[model samples]
Target: MFKVPPRPSTSRIPYAPLPNQGNDSGATPKASSPARSHRSSSGSCFETPVAAPSSSRRLSYAVNSGIKPSRPSSVSKGRSSIVAPAYSNLSSAKKPGEDPRPLKDKAYQADCIQNIYAFLESRGFDKPFDAGMLQLPSSKLFLKIFEFVMKQIDPRFKYGNKPEDDILDFVKGLHYPYNLSRSSLQQAGTPHTWPPLLAMLNWLVQTINFSDATSGPGTTAAQPAHLTPRRFEAGPLTNLTSETSPLDEEGCRAVFFEFMKESYNVFMNTEDETISDAKSQEMMQLFTTYFEEARQEVALDVENLKTELSRKEATLERMQDKSELKKLQEDKEILEKLLSDLIKETQRGEKDLQGYEEVLLDKQQELKKCAEITAGIQEDNALLCKRIQEQRFSKDDIEHMEEKLARRKAVLQMLKENRMHAGKEASKVEIQKVKIMEEIGQAAKKFNQRAAR
Candidate 1:
């Protein structure tokens, strides 16, 4: 506004400084000036509200506090206004060959070919890599990288920077490069030499072959500059051999050095053959001890089997004996039954004998009674004989006895007769006696009466 004079009317209106911008007079400016009829304007001048960082009062305050230096140039009021959208602080890809994916952009970095080559060349590119570097996390990755960059023209094997080239292109197209600014490509180790080295190889091979091929002016092989860079494939690793060319010397050096180092490490640290022999001896001793134990166990098992077989044979014998004894028991049972039958018969015979004895006793008893009867008859006969002897008289004796009795009776009769006869006589005699007594009594009485009288 110093170059172009401002109108007097501009001073009368209430002026406001635009967002974060102050007036030349160092005064607080606001948007209350209704019209900008004559304002000291520049490309940086903008009319924004107080609600933004563009607030006019805050710009005056910040300038007085020395929070920021004075603006050097002008601002355009009409440039594309990009209000920074609300966002979490995050890194983003800003280049053409950049990836848009999240988190991955942080993993690997992309760099221009120029910077990577400069750093590697300055290191003389011949130092044996620090062995400690290989033990680090991702160290093997660096090793794989460096291994890819070394090239060879061996027909028997394929080698070149093609693999690194491919990887570089991959990173350039896929990862964001800006965030890689903090990391020195040196941190990548020997592989940092890859891209420019590859480009140099391409240039070198082409220079040799191309210069020779195009040495004659009529031969024309140059193409349009827009043609893509020539591409080559990566090569396989190899051992040191006399056939390796001067160009191949570096590659052979790297490979053998790595291999020798590893072999040397193994030799120094590994066990010797004598130790191995001792281990083998110890194993043999253990095996011998176990073999003896196994032999004893097998012998014991054989003895046990023999004893078991004998026991089984004895059991079979016992079973046979039991079968024979069962037959014997059956036979004995039959004998016992026969014996019992014989005893029953004997008992019956004895009973019969007792009955016979009783009958005999009864017969004897009857015979004894008959004998007694016979004895009694004999006695009676004897008595009769005795009686006959005693009598000794027969019928004659009876007749004599009878004649005596008759005589007695006759005598009585005789006596009676006599008495009768005598009675006549006696009667006469008694009559005579009575007559005599009566006569005598009559005489005596007569006499006595006579006397008494």
Candidate 2:
């Protein structure tokens, strides 16, 4: 007898009620069939069984006999009658030996189920099955589903006598990212082993979707029409083809020569003395058609080449223009920077001119005072000249007059020296003023030039 492992006490396995079954509160349910009992036992071995209601005798009987209890009519039909047990709901706070690994969330499992169903429906699978069927401990239906999905990839592919080997081979060929051991593959339909299998199926579906999206008719149509070559239409031998032929003009000529050679050989070696005129005409016509097609093909090629060359030349010109435009832009930026600097220098020069104008005003005031003093000195000199001209003296008074004249000459010399020193200082000031004015003129000219530009 095969012994089954004990189920964990933390979880509960829910069973879907049969469609024909009815929930009658008053009536007592019959005992489960042997097959139902066996399935229930297996389910119990995999997950903890839910507690039956103590008040209901039918529920207690069903639990004792390994049969799922029916729910009241008030309960929702969409959900199973069995209440799923949770770790938090346990009466005991602690367990001595519990598996530390966490279980997959219900939401995740539901998502997987929905995706699997959607994939099957898109692949045109017509058979009806629910999530409950997938959760059952059976491999037959799941294997069939797996095979159906594999067939979508390759219709001709078939499972051989060794299905395990075939499955391994197919999975290996796909270069599946997840490692799939033989034991996992063997127990694929069981609840304990379904997660990896589900993952694998989902991956395969995604790959198929991706491949279809990448290589479908829509993708082909999205490509540029000019990129693909035009295919020649098939026609009879008498028709003059305008498109390219399989053989070139040289090949056609060779064939014609070969035909002529064979004809000559036949005429010389066989009973026939000369070739038939109709056959010769037919051969010539065929060769002529071939040559015409070859010529047209060559012409088409030349035209294509010319168009390509023109396009390339235009592209090259655009590229060169772009480079020149970039260079011009850089040059413009440099010129703009220089112009800014020149403007700043011009502003500074204007400021210096303002200060120089103030200094020039002071220098003009000093020149005015010096001119007044020179006018006073000129009056004094004029008086002295008049007095000297009017005076008449004897030989004894000549010495006294000479001594006074000497004193006047010394005063005149000192005055002359003062006038010369003042003139020299005025000249230096004028030179400085001229230099400043020149600089101001240059700055203004440069500013005007830049502004015009």
User: All predictions: root-mean-square deviation over Cα?
Assistant: 71.3, 40.4
Alpha carbon lDDT at 82, candidate 2: 21
The TM-score, computed over Cα atoms with residue i paired to residue i, of candidate 2 is 0.26
lDDT of each: 0.37, 0.50
Whole-structure CA lDDT of model 2: 0.50
Per-residue lDDT of model 2, residues 1-453, tens digit only: 101112113232112111122532212222221110011332221112112222212111211122222322221124332211111111111111222112244544555566567667766776677656655426777678777877666554556665655666555444343456668777777767776666556555555544333221222233333222222232112322334343645344334443433232222223322333344344445555655776788799999999999999998888689777899799999999999999999999999999999999999999999999999999999999999989877788998889999999999999999999999999999999999999999999999999999
TM-score to native of every candidate shown: 0.15, 0.26
Candidate 1 accuracy as lDDT: 0.37
Error of 2 at 273 (Å): 59
lDDT of 2 at 107: 49
Per-residue lDDT of model 1, residues 1-453, tens digit only: 111111123323223212223454422333232211111233121111111222222111211121221221111123221111110000112232221222112111122122223333332445444433332314345434333222211112221233333333322222112223114233443444333322322222222232222122212233222121211111111222333332244433333333222222222222454543343334334333433544686688899999999999998888689777899799999999999999999999999999999999999999999999999999999999998888667898899999899889977887787767876886678777878888888888888987896
Clashing pairs in 2: none
Candidate 1, poorest ten consecutive residues by summed lDDT: 82-91
